[model samples]
Target: MVTPAVSGGDLARVAIVGASLGGMSTASGLRGHGFDGEIVMVEAEAELPPDRPPLSKQVLTGEWPLERARQPGSATLDELGVDLRFGRRAVRLDVATRTLTLDDHETVSADAVVLATGSAARRPPIPGIDRPGVHLLRTGADAAALRAGLAATPQRVLIVGAGFIGLEVAGSARELGLPVTVVEAFATPASRVLPPAIGMALAAAAVDAGVDLRTDTSVEALLGPGVEGAAGGDGDAPVAGALLSDGTTLAADLVLVAVGAVPASGWLSDTPGIDLDDGVLADATAMAAPGVAVVGDLARWWHRGAGGFVRVEHWDNAIEMGRYVGARLMARDDAEPYTPVPWMWSNQFGAKFQLAGHVSPDDALTWIDGTPEDRAWVGVTHDGTTVKSVMGYNRNPKVMRIRMRMDGPDGLALVDLLAAESTQ
Candidate 1:
């Protein structure tokens, strides 16, 4: 129920909250859509430089630099005449007043507001969780801190969760000559994202990297045996020891939690009608509130074709959604909704994994390229009769083919095409 705010007149002010991937994408999208009105961007992160997924993969492994991972869009804002507030986290949203309140008690007025505040890495809830050696890679600072920890004499490192982040960390840790152990609640790494068959391949890569993997294992608790001979025993949140469900206690000099992240939605507490189900609710047009619309991760609006509002947290979704939101804001006329194919990538153990389309848990999976033993292949997920998604390991060409079939209704035939290629 978006309030039809027929007010605000010609000087409609649009405020986009966030400085990271979501914030930058939203602001840039507005400009691309020909939005000439006043546009303001709010972000709490320290730097405007982009810190992408590669920072956790290649940056820590001495392959890429801090300067290389930046978003490469701050200069574009100046050219687009966008006002940016860097290093300031917006804490509240007053939809009635069309005002966004910041943690610093600053109130920003706008006719439309988009909450594109993205997500951060989650830390395991445990005592001494904030210990000196315990690290969570959410920002550039976190990655830098973890990098420094790895440089030390390389004691036993414990990583909780074998998802994309966890596996990537384990790969890097092993590559650096550090003894690492990975504990996952699921039987295989990335089981939630990929089918069990495909996930087995990813798990093998982690094992190949000398990662001690404990499947179907959960940490009953995080314990702090206290840092070895530290000056003082400040138990605090810093953890030095962890207790597993199997009654095993491991001495951990360094522990990393790469579980997962959710959208930061504390600011949208009372801002209803914008779609707050998992994220801010909005349509394909990115419209949330009356004059306000949302794009990127926070826009949780549904799609008729996909069957629901998908707040996809991937690289392509952010860019594609932002482009749609921006173009609609500028057109000032009837515009088509965005129905983009979701795509994401992860680099681990010298392997590159890419995916296109939305492959859900309920979707039927059929392997089409490479083989499980070969450590390489492409897979497609079907929605009964149509190819809904395509995933691959070192298979970009196949990924491209699936991308072409995404918007068309004839995608169901993709499954046959992939099966033929797989046999070849």
Candidate 2:
């Protein structure tokens, strides 16, 4: 069954069970690289997949239509001779036989399989969270519904988390003149993703934009519009307010729960040879099992350059990983190891925050340009003397420039690089 794409001879068939950005990219890459095989992409969602990042910003803000947000090169799937099965869910994977059973009882067997089912938004265990006005945005439909709700002119909007999505949504709400209140258990917005100083600066940016940023705050329960003990509306109401852990109730016409997301890997539970921790355990080349590759958010692969295993959720990482895996599958010789300089950007509170490479909050951060108070800076992280990561707060050009020179022997020193680049 191994073809030149997978091992040598010509590949006959390949099946991708996801139809997400990664899946789309993999399919395109396979065909583009002369792998004249029968490519099939199965997707659970009825509508064709769209770029998800815009779901929180432009799509919700009515600046971009859903159709406009379709994944890049999506239209050429048909031209590439790909069989796209929409609304088809992969229920089980039989690795022994290399077969995938769909929900409709149809089985698609292929020489190689790529699992990119992506992730689903996490819904916390808050009481009354199932109320009509409480929403979670993850998909296109979710974004549309949230936008429709916002169109009704809500008195106040309460967001349950201060992650990237939560803050972006709050910014969108403020743009619509809706009073936005963000409740985060952490001390600052984007605390988990960015350095503490950068996170605090982002929190200030949100507040400056008229957001009622509530850090160190947790929503104990969601009160219904009609609950007996709930504040505001009676039993007929949808969601009236949220009860906070600090003994207070915040009235809201709509509540968005942006806690986070979990990998959508339940279908691969019984599949042999595929290690699943938080995601599908794959090698640097995204090889999950023999003839099986995993990408996107559901792949936790050993990064050759990073010196560790990381599961990146950014759009760029998904595209790059998919392309790398596709090329690896097609080549007769083993392709170069998958070691990407991961990059991601967030649009929050009318600022563009771009990050290149990886950095933990514990890493030593040296501000290369501007101050946290100025809300614009380029920062670099180091592991003792070697540069580990770089971040830009409204410094996209500098970040892009600095990231280019980050992979050499002399590039280990961040302070020297900053000094040299500043003079340029």
Candidate 3:
């Protein structure tokens, strides 16, 4: 059992940065844990933070209204006695004093501070990237702009990455009958997360859906209009296409750069004692300092299961970490190390892909229920002994059950259990 970092009674006020899903979750968890202290949430965006998962699918496809993507409204936070500070960005932090300097030059000092600044979309240092018609989807504004761009009906849609976001957007584009081309630097789509076999199987579905999936390809540069053979723009105007490393140029009226994101930890660069290596470093208890806790994508904390520190940017991780840190701060739950089986899901080509627990490309994967060719399967990955992760495509029930077992002793005996079930 880990010891609580700060007692509930000692916390007179708590200041949360980002107002992201994780930040909001922390605030709500504190209130739910009976913390009557003042709760202040400072967000860089003036409007309420919107749910991001929908931005790629429903929001992009115009199936869901943009207003429906909002997580919790001001009224909801107000009911919990939260002091919502919208449009206020934290520019600096003094961990020792538990004071945060906002971009507006206002200093907010609290008994405890929670860092949930999250991440920002990574825009590669390529020329013509700043031009119109080239978009990076991270925020609600980005989604709206991309959606509007799609409404304009570009002849060719080019996505510069085969990550979840890029693939989901590709599926959405295809659903609108637009010609989509996805370029991935890796051999498979979502190679950073999914194993090659699984990614290739999903890539087949995208191809079947009329997406021109290009693997092992990279975008050298975004070609602006007036370039030789560039389409859809006048001289020196919006992005007309891209120059690939293979010496091939693809004409794209619209380009979505979904390469990846980086932790929003630049403000804490000068802050002493806070280790900033890719993200804000924290202990297994999610505590960064005596009264400081870091949650969400910005937290790079020790994972007992992984045997090292990991920074998870998934939506579920944000919620779980927020609740755990909140309970720890208030001393509400047993002092247990924050160890969670990281889970993430994506929707593409009308199939739901779910992955639970940390997985590596090198992990040995075995199909437990169905084959990948079926486009609906449940598989588990193992490190020669214990199961490390479970992934499924449209097999939610089996995948979830296996995922739940991963936290128990049965997880280690999964192979034997599956063998036994197979004989029956």
lDDT of each: 0.73, 0.83, 0.86
lDDT of 2 at 123: 87
Per-model TM values vs. the true structure: 0.90, 0.94, 0.95
Candidate with the greatest TM-score versus the true structure: 3
Q: Model 3, range 6-84, lDDT digits (tens) per residue?
A: 5578889999998888998898889888899888889999887789999999998889988889774335866777898
Q: Write the per-residue lDDT of candidate 2 for residues 131-202, one digit (tens) a residue.
A: 888899888888889989888999999999999899999999998889999999988777776778878888
Which 10-residue window in model 2 sums to the lowest lDDT? Answer: 1-10
- What does candidate 1's lDDT look like per residue over 1-424, in tens digits? 2233222234367888877666677667766655678888887877674656776777777777766777747556678677888888888777767788888899999867777787666665655566677788878888788887887755689998898888888888777888999989888887777778778888887888898999998776666655333322566645666777787777777888878877777667765555577877776566777667676666687665587777788877777777676666665536666677778888888888888877766578887777767877887888667787888887877777767767664444754665666686
Cα displacement (Å) at residue 238, model 3: 0.7
TM-score ranking of the models: 3, 2, 1
Ranking by lDDT: 3, 2, 1
Candidate 3 stretches greater than 4 Å from native: 1-4, 72-75, 229-236, 332-334, 420-424
